[model samples]
Structure formats: C-alpha cells, structure tokens
Target: MYGIKTRLCLSVLFALTLISPAWAQTFDFGEIKSPILFQGNYKYAYRDPAVVYHEGKFHLYFTLVEKAKDKGMYWYTAQSVSEDLVHWTYPKIITPCDRNLNYSSPGNIVRKDGQWIMCLQTYPTPNKERFGNKDSRVWIMRSEDLENWSEPELLKVKGNDVVVEDMGRMIDPYLLEDADEPGKWWCYYKQNGVSMSYSYDLKNWTYAGNAHSGENVTVIRQNGEYVLLHSPRNGIGVKRSKTPQEWGEDEALLTLGQKDWPWAKRRLTAATVVDLTKEKRFGKYIMFFHGSPVNPKNPRSDAHNKASLAIAWSDDLKTWTWPGKNSQPK
Candidate 1:
C-alpha cells in the first residue's frame, strides 16, 4: 500500500538519516548470504543499499527506513526489481520531493547517454544539524526504464573537482557502467576516502581523484581488470587500478582474520560488485558488503543497527577469500 506519491517520498528521509551507533536493533537486517540469494528482509532490502545491472535485470535500490535515521513521514529512495537474481518485487517509492532539499542517501545506479542514471548524495541545504555540512551535493537522475526514475537534480561538483573530504565517512553515491569500457562510465564513490568519477552524459562530471585512503567504495570490471572494495580498517580490503586515474594504495583482500562470520561484521559499509563474466570463476568476482552482526552485543548493535550483506571472492583483484557458506544459495 504505497501510493500517496510513494508514501510522500519516505516522509522526508527521517529528517536526515546518518546511522552508525550500530543502527540500534531488530536483527536479520536483510540478506547477503556471502554473495548471492538473500531473503532476509525480502532479500536484504534498504539501509544503505545500492546495486545495478539494468537491461537484464538486477536493480536493487534501498532506504525505506523506519529508523535507520527516520526517513519517513516523507522519505523516499526505494526500489526493487530482480527477475531471477533471487526474489524481490515489493517496493516502489522512487525519489520524491523537490523543494530543493535534494533527497540524498547512498542510492547508486548508472547507465548513461541513453538514460538510466542515479548518482545521489543529496542535501545541499536543509538543516538537520549534520555537522559542519559541506552542503553535501552530487546529485543526478534520469531514466529510460528502471520503472521511470527522474527528479534528482544538481550534480556539477566543480571548482576543485573534490579530492577528499569525508570526516566520519558515510558516503555512498556509487555507480558503475563500464561493460569492459563502453561509453566509459565508471564511478566508485564514497565520502572521505574512496572516490573516482567519469561520465559521458550523466549531466557532466569528471572527478577522477582519491582511492588512496580506504572507505565504502564499490567498483567492478572483470577480466579486463579494476577492483576496489574498501572500508573498515584492516582486512576485507582491495584496491587495484588500471585506469580511473591510477588508484595506488590499498592492499588487503578480506579481513576480520581467521575467517569466520558466525553472525557477520568485518566487511564494512554499503557495497556491491558483480562481473561474473559468464560465471567462469578465477578471473571471477563477486563482492557485496555491509556488516554488524556477530553478536555485537545482541541488542541489535544499536547506533542504528541494520547492516548485513556479505560475499567475497577474487583470484586477482589482489587476492580475497571469505568463502563462507560457499557463496550461499541452498
């Protein structure tokens, strides 16, 4: 029952969702059984979610928060569409509201020229007291299909092209479109550390910088090479560069050591990468991240708790192996 303009666009995104005290409670959080097939909350839906594969079908857009930061009363940014990527077909609300608060979050999707775009980060001004606030801007929207996606203006980000400026770091405006390099659209975003951008016509952008520090940044390019999964502190990391302006810093594939996610929490912050290349394995890759489980004190880990989604494997994205549940799907 979501129609009054998609619940008024999720009631204004909980006034300004930020999340982290661990996301305060209520478990299962949403599937990520290592790498594929999730059914937890209708298959890991919402709370820092972002994924795209268009044309063939694999569009997972999130943020239907009841508390991950409030985002209700008029909060939008929700979507779902997976033909066989394992169940999902319930949410609808797609980016509502426009007095200029510029609805923002970690919703990432990209296509280019023909359309289908989403860069997201939102909030140029609409005080919720999110500290210092650089005004947060990096928005864009246009769609040909993904069920009609529009309304996400202002995305220039010039003057300095921005290199790095994430403090407590929680930025997810990710987007990837380089089926080997066609039209050349690759954007691996984040707030402070992980960054990089390039576009053909997602409304003009060229900020290929950062990728040297380490933080929630997802990017994929199989066989041809280009992998970067960053966040947390130690393990669960990988940063390799070839184009995207030569990212040369990070170097660890999986972390939390000894390997064991009885519950989860090691793989850090919003992430997702897929490029099976016809499911060959080796030159293979699959990584989707988000953590805070492993009984982080059970009370649901609080801070805004609601982070779960896992999967890891890479023979040459610089090495990684968290084969738990053998990439689930039983």
Candidate 2:
C-alpha cells in the first residue's frame, strides 16, 4: 500500500512539472539529430518554419505546399511535433485547401492571456502568378491548446482607417512582446521594407512605423537589447536596436555553410530562432531555417518546391554549427 501511494504521488508531480513554464529549464529531449528538419520533393515542399517548445516537446509550424493534378499547387499552414528532435510526427494540415486563401508563411506564435496566438499571411495566387497578388494581407489566429485554432482573422496592422483592400501586399507576420512594456505587443511584417504595428488587445492595432529590412523578420529580446533576424537575398541577416521602433542598419549577413551543403546551395532563408540558452539540454540558441536545392534546369521550381527545412545552432548568435559539420563558425 505504501509503494502504491508513493508511485501515485510521483506521477502527479511529473505531470505538474510538464505544464509549468518554470520547470522547462531542467527538461531534456535527448540528443539532437541531423540539421535537415524536413526534406522536400516534387510532391510536397516545406518552408517558412515557426517553432515553439512547450510541455517538453517541440512543435514546429510551417508552410506546406502540395501539388495537385487538377488544381496545380496549393498551400496550407501545417504542424508537426517532435520529442527528441530526430524523429517527428507526420505533419497535419490545419488550414483549408483553397488556393485563393493559401494561408502560408506562419511567422511565429505567442501566448497571451492563457491563449496561444499565431500570425500568418494569405498569399493569393489565383491566376497562377509566381507571387501573391496585391490582395495578400496579414492575419492572426487564436488557439486554446495550440492544437485547435480559430479561423483566420484579418490583422489590420495597417490600422483601422487603411481598410483591408488598401493594405497592399504584406506577408511574413511575426509577433513579439515589447521589451520594456508588459502589455504592449508588436507585429512586424514585410511591406515597405518591414512595417511595424502595436496592439494592446491583439484585436485592435495601431500603425507605428517602418524600417529598411529584409523579409521573414523575427525578433527576440536578448541581454536587454532587441535582436532582429531578417532574410536578405541569399541568407539571413541580423540587425540590432535598443527598441523595436528604431533599428540600426544591418550588422552581419549570415549564410551558414551554404557553400558546402548541396541542399542549401541555391538559397537559405526564412530563419527562426528559439533561445534555449537557459535550458540545460540545449545550452545554445537554436535556429531553424529552410533551404532550396540548386536546379539549373528549373530555377523557378526551387522557389515553390525542392526546398527543405534545416536546423543550426549558435552560442553567441554570431558563430554557428550544424549536425554533420565540424562546428565551423559563420
């Protein structure tokens, strides 16, 4: 009887630890795997990854592109989970299959008021255009458990007066909390070189400002400073600022081992950083980025398909290392 009671008590404590954020530091997911997160083919391609570590598991969200015989190609916001970073569960599509509403490029996810919110964009290529039409706009969805998300709601990051149709072509929406302010939140998207908007309730937003930056912008607050990572033409670029409103010029452009890796020879972009420096298992900052293979015959195919999701890590956000490399600093 005593052994049974002790075992029950220990199980209850473990369950509580998994749900507590403060206990994340001690959680371990075992050894890391190869840098390739997801491999793409002619049938499917994965891009624009937005990842989060919750309850001792890594939940990765990205844009899943599928090729259809009758419809050509369509995109959906999909998700996959991994416990050890080596093996991942099969991806599950969470959004619709409509080409006009191709809800892809999930920037990132944030938790507010006991709910998880994810920001994304609608890339409408109804006419088989290479890029999204002018009707492209930013949006957000809310979820209670990060599994079942609400319908996509338009994010008037351009403000209430601008109107939805006049928002123009804005994509790659990333959400970040203010470094100094507690309740104030910022949404950074690609427009006039990355525009900024602030929101207090996540529903109503006020246009703040814009800056000269690249696409797929992801920001993190480190050492009392804001570190902004944006994707330039070939690789990911880094910029720094004390505040989100005012950002300095690009400091460094990082293309980690693209020259050596054949899979990333064409391009390496859409990088997202997850700072697990405090955690004992992954004591460095983890970066997940997607790359496209070189296709001389079909150059345009690299943009839509033949792209792959890969991983890399850094100790100081400057020098980097990957799975099979010799820990070369970039």
Candidate 3:
C-alpha cells in the first residue's frame, strides 16, 4: 500500500546501510590490566617491546636483560604469545644473546615470500663505553616458523659498508613497508634524531637522512597517513608525515609523573604502537611501552632502566586511557 515516492526513499535508506562501513566495536579501557608483562626475580627486566599479530595470536618480542656479576650485563630478545592481549604465555628466547655481542631492541617482524624476517640492533658486549656507530649495526635473521631463526647477518647498504653512517650511532631500528613507493621498505632508527634509510631487499639499505628528532621510533599508517611515535625526555611524543622522509612537527602524547600510573611513574620509553583496525577482539590502537621506577638513591642514573611493560589503548590514535582508577590524561 506504499506510494512510489515512499518506496523509493526506503530503498535508498537500505542501500546506504548496506554500503556504509561498519563501525569498529569500542574497547573498554578498564578491562586491560597494567604491567601486562613484567619480570622481577633473578635481576631480570623487560624493555623495548616489539609486537606483531601473526597466525591469530599476538607475538611480543622485547629485550630481556640479566644483571649478574659473573655474566655481567646480557641482552637478548625474548618472546611471549597471547591470544587476547590481556594474557600471555612466555616462550623460550627468540634471539639468544651472543657471548661477544649485545642483541638489543627487537624491531618489526614482517612476512615476505612465505618467510619471516626479524631485525635488531647489536653492539659488542663488555664495552663500558657508550655505543658508537663503529660498534653498532643492525642485523637480521629469517625464519620459516616464528620459532627457529637463521644466523644473524649484518645488514649492509648498497655501496656503503655500514648499515648506517659511521658519524652517527644507530639503534632501535623499525621497519615499515613504504606505502607511497610500492615494493620498497623504510627503516627508521635513532641516529642523533630519527634517521631513515630505504631498501628493496630489506637487507641492503641506503642511508637517507634524519627524518626527525626522537628515539625508539615506531611508525604506523592510519587513515592513509603515517604517524611516528617515539620516546624523548622520558615521555612519549608523536609526529605525522604523509611521506616517511618528512615529519612535520612533534606533539607530546604521554609523559611520566603527569598521571598517577605507578608502573609508568619514573620513565616511559621504547614504545611500540600496534594498529588493530582489523582485529576482532579489540579494534583500537594499542601502545606498549617500557616503564621504570626511579631509584630512590640515584634517581637520575637509574631512571632510564626500563623494568616493565605497560599498555594504553586509543580509539582515535589521539586520546588514550590507562587501566587504573585515575586514568584521566593530565
């Protein structure tokens, strides 16, 4: 009994509902437990978390340190798998510490041509001096499954002998597939300020230049734009760019001592931001970072030691909420 004009209007409304994209389910920030992953006994601590969702599970790789007198300081990549980001199962070391080298800052894990690749930074062990470009370099390994890995090999540039230039030291290498330029990859690392390099093979890189000024850089693509997150001055900041080479400006996102989150009170560093747009359980951006406590005796020196892994969630990649009762951003 409907008129022709009424039927046409109803048909249009039905078409619009079918074509419009479904909005992702909102995640409750209160459900996430703080210090999602940590280490306590045996003088062991976690730092530099690198996260990737693979095979329906979240794999978290991070720098595991052991402070012992006989062994001295050792750094290796340890892994944990979680079906739901809330609970995790600790696995054996993914990348073992070399006797003569310190394997630190596990980078991105990308699957290409049915093979898995993991990149990390390395420096000679037992060196009490600060890390220099001469001693530091990025190395890579390949795996069929996520468990066993090939021997670590130095990542060399096309013409240059070093991965990064010798004048500036580099660490915390994060790999991203260059969206603007197809078939190319971008590696962003800390060299004075966030430095960049381009590669086609992922092993042979060409040093580009400094993209911006930040450390522990993690880049993600959101809504066709690239966002870079880094830790500077014991806080988390963000930079945006349409192209990977030119980051416009910096904005402080999160900071320690601003909120009463106990785990992140002293310092917040080595952040890894995971984009969960297509994820089933939680379709929001999740940031995992290392937090440390201020040494009551030597606050300045001990503040940089990252002892635990903390997490925050965001709906729009701008506003974030923590787990605790006083989770309001200051």
Candidate 4:
C-alpha cells in the first residue's frame, strides 16, 4: 500500500512539472545564420511577427499568407516554436479559413487570469481588394496553452457607445498594462494614426485618443519611459515618451543592413522587440521583423509573396546587430 501511494504521488508531481510555465530556464542559441530567420517562398509569405518566450522556448506567431485554390490569398495567424533561434518547428495555422474574415497580424501575447490573451486584426481583402475593407477590426483570442486558441472576440476598442460596424477600419492591435496604474490595460491599434483604448477587464474598452505614429506599433516600458517601435515608409522608427498617451520625437530610423540584405531591400517593417535584458543568459533585446525581397526595377516587386522574417538584437535600442552581418550596428 505504501509503495503504491508513493508511485501515485511521483506521477502527479511529474505531470505538474511538465505543465508549469518556466521562464527562468536558460537556453544556448547556437550559431544564428543569415539574418533571414524564415525565408518565404513564392507560395508562402510570412509577415507581422509577434514573439513570446515562455517555458524556455520561443513562441513565434505571424501572418501567414498563402495563395487560395481558386484565386486571391488567405491570411492566417500561424505559430512556430523554437528552443534555439536557429531551428524551428513546422508552423501550424491556428485560425479558420475564411476570406471575409482573414484573421492575421498577431500583435503580441499577454497573460491574464489563468489563460493567455493575444491581440490580432482581421484583414479581410475578399474580392481581391488591396487592403482590408471597413470591416477590418481588432480582436483578442484566449488560450490556456499557447498552441491552441479560442475563437477571436471583437475588441470593440471604439468604446461600448459606438456600434461594431461603425468602429471604422483598424488593425495591428497591441496590449500593454499601465505601468503606473495596476489592473488598467491599454489596447493600441492602428486607425487614425495609432489610437488607444483602455479597459479594466479585457472586455469593455473606452476609447482614448490617438498618437501621431506609424502602423504596427509595439510599445515597451523601459526605465520609466515608454519606447515605441513603429513602421514608417521603409524601416522601423523609434520614439520615446514619458507616458503612453503622448510621444516626444523620433530617436532613430533603423534600416538594419537593408542595402546589403537584398532579401529585405524592398522594405523592413512590422518590427517587434522582446526585451530580455533581465535574463542573465540572454542579456540583450531581441527583435523580429519581416522584410520583403528587393526588386531593382520596380522596387516593390515580390514585396508580398517573397517577404521573409528576420531577427536582430540590441543591448541598447539605438544600435542593433544580427548574425551573418558585421558586428557594427547598421
């Protein structure tokens, strides 16, 4: 009887260990090759990267665009995992297949309650439209494990007073907790130059105002200041502010090796940074951004289909370095 009881206890403890989220575990990111992390082919295009490091593994969520069987393209929120930055698991599409609700562009992931919340946008380009119509809206999805996700729930960031259809076009939703105020959450989306909305719970939101910024905005708090990384015309632009409500000015515009990197010669945008400076093993800020292949004649040719994902790291936000490139900040 005693032996059986001990065996049962051991099994339960082992199971709990596997399910626990381990942020402290350190990893050795062996030799990172060319800055091009994931090379997109003619058929598959990867863009809008959002990353989270949990359980000692890197979870990468991005917009996966594939050519549809009949015509047009399908955008999906897909995920891939990696322990070392060099190798990654096969990507799995987490969203359903619907042209009208082409769910893509996962901005970032946050933990609330007991589940994980991810903010994204619906870029419906049905009928071969260039961009999402007025129906484009921001949303959030819940997940206990990062692998599986629940159906997206509309963010309604325009405020409860406004109707859903009247919210106007919005995309690239990022969630951040107010540093000065606890339990108060902020949702930043791109509408009229990066508008913001706040909510106590993730459900109801009250529209705040807008900031003069570019699209795909990801803000991080460092040393009591909010650091905003955004996409301008062809590169990632940086801005700093005392608070989230307002921004000061552009600190720098980073076009990391775009001239040398033909894969990213066309454009380098949608840059998302994960500051892991506290982690002793990895004491630098890691950034993931997608770049489009260059075309000398058109300069925009193969911009959509052959776009690829890339990585860069920085000790300070001003300077960045990536593998297969010179050590100097570009």
lDDT of every model, 2 decimals: 0.52, 0.87, 0.73, 0.87
The TM-score that candidate 2 achieves is 0.89
RMSD of each: 21.4, 4.7, 6.7, 6.2
Model 2: lDDT equals: 0.87
State the lDDT of candidate 4 residue by residue for 210-300, as single tens digits: 9888899999988889999998888999999888888757899999888887778788999999988987657789999999886666765
Residue 244, candidate 3: C-alpha displacement in angstroms: 0.8
Better of 1 and 2 by TM-score: 2
- Let me know the TM-score candidate 1 reaches against the reference structure: 0.27
Tens-digit lDDT string for candidate 2 (1-330): 459889999999999878856334443433454678789887898999999888777889999988777646788999999766777889999999887989999999999999999999999888766678898898999999889999999999877888787888999999999978999999999999989999998778999889999899999978888999999888999999999889878999999888887778888999999998877757778899998888879765637776789988888999987876765444
- Model 3 stretches with alpha carbons more than 4 Å out: 1-30, 39-42, 128-134, 161-168, 256-258, 303-306, 325-330
Candidate 3 versus truth, CA RMSD in Å, comes to: 6.7
Work out how many backbone clashes candidate 2 has. 0
On a 0 to 100 scale, what is the lDDT of residue 329 in model 2? 47
Q: Tell me each candidate's TM-score.
A: 0.27, 0.89, 0.83, 0.89
